[model samples]
Target: MRTAYSVETVRGAERELMGRLPEGALMQRAAAGLAVACGELLGRVYGSRVVLLVGSGDNGGDALYAGARLARRGAGVVAVLLSPERAHQGGLAALRAAGGRVSDDALRDIGRADLVVDGIVGIGGRGGLRPEAAQLARAAWESARVVAVDLPSGVDADSGEVHGDAVRADATVTFGAYKPGLLIDPARERAGALRLVDIGLTLPEDAEMEALQHADVADLLPRPVPESDKYRRGVVGVVAGSARYPGAAVLAVAGALRGGAGAVRYVGPAAEAVLAHFPETLVHPGPPDKAGRVQAWVIGPGIGEEADALEEVLAAEVPVLVDADGLRFLSPQRTRERTAETLLTPHAGEAAALLGRGREEVEAARLASVRELAAQYGATVLLKGSTTLVAEADGPVRVNPTGTSWLATAGSGDVLSGVTGSLLAAGLPARDAGSVGAYLHGLAARRAAGPAGAPILASEVAAHLDAAWRDVTD
Candidate 1:
C-alpha cells in the first residue's frame, strides 16, 4: 500500500525530526537527497547547468542547499530567488559558500539550463503559482526538464486541487510519505513520475488516503481451485433494468459473465431481453425477494423509480451493490439496518443527489464527497469519474490510476456494477471487490478501444475483461 498523508501531518513530522537532530540537519538531508537525484538526471554533476526557482519558505531553502551541493561538484548552479529577502538565511549562506551564484536575470538564462528544480512552494502552499512564479514555471516547462521538491509548486498538497497556474514536472521527489494530491487526478497528471525518499519520519496510523501497489492488488485478487464447482465459485443475483432500458440488463450480464462468478440469476421486467441477449443467464420475471439464493446481489443500473425493487434488494442477507438508479431510492438509515455488506457506486451526478449538492460541487471536491458518503451510509463508496475513488467506512480512501475519458459512454457504469457484484459474490472483501473491479473495468475499456481510436461498445469492454485480468496478474 502506498499511503498519503495530509500537509499538516508532513509538517508535524518534519518538526518532530527537526527537534531531535542538530540545527539544519533535516534540511541538509532533504537537500542532499535532492542533489543526488538531480545528478542522476544530468548524467554527470560537472559541467551541467542547474537553475533553482526559489520561493520565500523552507521549500526555497531546500532548493538553495541542493543547488549548493551541485555547485561544489563543479556544476554551474544559479539560484533565481523569488523572495530574496525572506529566503532561508542558513540555506542561502551554504549555497554562496559552495560557489553557487544568485541572479535576477533568470528567465533569459533559464532556457540554457539542462534541468530546473521547482522549490517555489512545498506542502504549505494553498493555490497555484503566484503571477511571477507562474510565468517562470511556464517557461521552464516549455524548455527544461523539471524536478519538483516534496511536491510540484502551486498544487494543493492536501486536496490535490490546482487553483490556477501549477508547475508540471517531469518528476516529483517526495520525502517521508506521499501526499493525497499526488495520487489524485488533475494534480496527479501534472506529476509525471513519482519518487519517494525516506527521511525517517513516522507517519500516523490515521492517514487519509492510499494507493494499491501491484503486490497488494495481487494478494487481494481471488484465486480459484480445482475443487471449485459452479455454485462454489459463487452465484450472483442481478436486479437491474426496466422496460424503458433493456440494454442495461444485457450489458450488466456481460460484465457478470467476465467476472469469476459461476452463475448469474437476473430478476427484472427485462428478463426476456436479457435471456435473448445472453442465453446462459438464468432470468426470472419476478421481484428481488423471490430471486432465489445468491452469494451477492447487484441492484439498480437501469431501474427507474421502482421503490419495491430497491427495497427488496436492500433487505437481502448477502453483499449488495447499489448503483445508478438504485442510488436514487437509498436511505442511510435503511442501509444501516442490513446485516450484510453494502457497496455504493455512484457517478458524480448520483452522488450529488445522495448528498443534496450540485454535480459541480461533488466533482470539485470528490475526495470529501466519497469519504462523506462512506461515513454517512456505513458502507463502502465508489465515486466514478475521471479519477475513480473507493472509500471504505472507516479506512483510508484509494484513488484508481487506470482510466480514460472514453469510459464516459452510456452503460459503462452498469457493466462496472455487475463486475463488482460478481467479485463480492466470490467472497472478496467489499473494498477489494470495488477497487479491483474498477481497475479491470478501466483496462478492459482501454483494450477495446485500440490505438487507432476504434469505437468500442459496452459489450466489447466486457469481452476484454479476461485479457485485462491476465495482463495485471501476469
Candidate 2:
C-alpha cells in the first residue's frame, strides 16, 4: 500500500529524526537526494541552466543547497530569492562558494532556463501564492520544465485543497514520505508525476490516508471454504431500478452476481428486465422487507424518489448501501437513528445536496467533505471521483489507486454500490466493505478499458470483475 501521513505526524517524525542526527545532516541528505533527482531530469547537468525560486523557509534552503551541488557540476545555477533578507544564510553562502549567482530578474531567468525548481512555499504555507510569486510560477510553468521541491507551492499539504493560484509542476520530488495532498485530487492534478526520496525517517503504521495495493486487496477478499454452502457464503439483496430505467437493475445485478456473494436476490419494479439478463438472480416484485432473507441490502440506483423502498431498506437488520435517488430524502437524523451499519456512496453533486452546499465546494475539498459527511451522517462514506475515497467517523481514509478515467460512464455508481453491498453481506465491516469494493471496481474498470484503452460501457466494467478478482488473488 502507498500511505501518506498527516502534517502533524510528519513534523513529529522529522523532529525525532533531526534530534538524532547532527545539526544539518537531515538537510544535507534531502539536498543530496534533490540534486540527484534534478540531475536525472536534466540528463546533462553540466552547462544546464537551472533556476530556483527561493522562499524564506527550509524548502528554499533545500533548493539553494541543491542548486549549489549542480553549480559545482558546471551547471549555470541562479537562485531567484522571493525573500532575500530572510533566505537561509548557510544555503546562500554555499551557493556563492559553489560559483552560483543570485538574480533579481526571476521572470527573465525562468524564461531562459532549462528547468525551474519551485520552493516558493512549503507544507506550512496556508494560502495561495503572493502576486510576485504567482506571476513567476505562471511564467515558469509556460517557459520551462518545473520540478516542485517536496510539494507544489500554494496547495494545502494536508487536505489537498487548492483555493487560489498555485504552482503547476511537471513533477514533484517529495522528501522522506508523501503528504496526503500528493495523492489526492485538485492538488494532485497540479502535481504531475511524483517521486519519493527516502531520508530514513520512520513513521507510524497508521497513516492519515492509504491507497490499497493488489496483495492487500487479495488478503481482504473473502474466499469460499470446503464447508461453505450457498447460504453460508452470503446473499446480497438489491433494491434498485424502476419501470422507466430497467437498465439500472441489470447493471447492479451484474456487479453483485460476480462479487463474493453466493447469491443475488433482486427486488424492484425492473424484475422482468433483471430476470431476462441474469436468469440466476432470484427476483421479487415487492418491498425490501417482504423480499425474504438477505445478508445485506443495496437500495436506490434508479428508483427515482422512491422514499418508501429506501425507508424499508434502511430499517433492515443488516448492513445497507444507499446510492443515487436513495440519497435524495436522507437526513442526518434519519441516518443516525438506524440500528444497522449504513454506507453512503455519493458523487460530488449528490454529496453537495446531502451537505447543503454546492457541488464545487464538495469537489474542491474532497477529503474534508468525505470526513464531514461520514461524521454528520454517522456512517461510512465512499466519495466517487478520479480518486475514490472511503471514509468513516474514525481511522485513516482509504484512497483507491486502480481507477481509469474511462470508468466515468453511465451506471458506474450503481455497479459500485452493488459490489460494496455484497461485500458487507459477506461479513466484512462497513469500512472494509466500502474500501475493498472500490479497489476491485476500479481495477475491473482498468482491465475492461484494455491495454490501448477504449471508451468502455459500465456493463463492460461489471463483466471484467472476475478478471480483476483473479489478478488480485493470483
Model 2 worst lDDT run, 10 consecutive residues: 304-313
Each prediction's TM-score versus the true structure: 0.91, 0.96
Total residue pair clashes for candidate 2: 0
lDDT at residue 357 of model 2 (Cα atoms): 100
As a whole number from 0 to 100, the lDDT of residue 392 in candidate 2 is 94
Where does model 1 exceed 4 Å of error?
40-48, 72-75, 204-206, 305-307, 449-456
Q: What is the lDDT of residue 452 in candidate 1?
A: 60
lDDT of each: 0.87, 0.91
Error of 1 at 138 (Å): 2.8
Global lDDT for candidate 2? 0.91
Per-residue alpha-carbon lDDT of candidate 1 for residues 1-474, written as tens digits (9 for 90 to 100): 788999888989988998899988888888988898888988998999999999988889989999999999999888999988988888888889999889769887688889999999988889777899999999999889999998999888887778889999999988889999898767887887898888889889887897766667667777779998878999999988988989888889889878878899999888888888889898887777786789999999888876588777877789999998888889999998889999999999999999999998887778878989999998999999988999987878988877577788889999999999999999998898999899889888889887666677788888899988887788
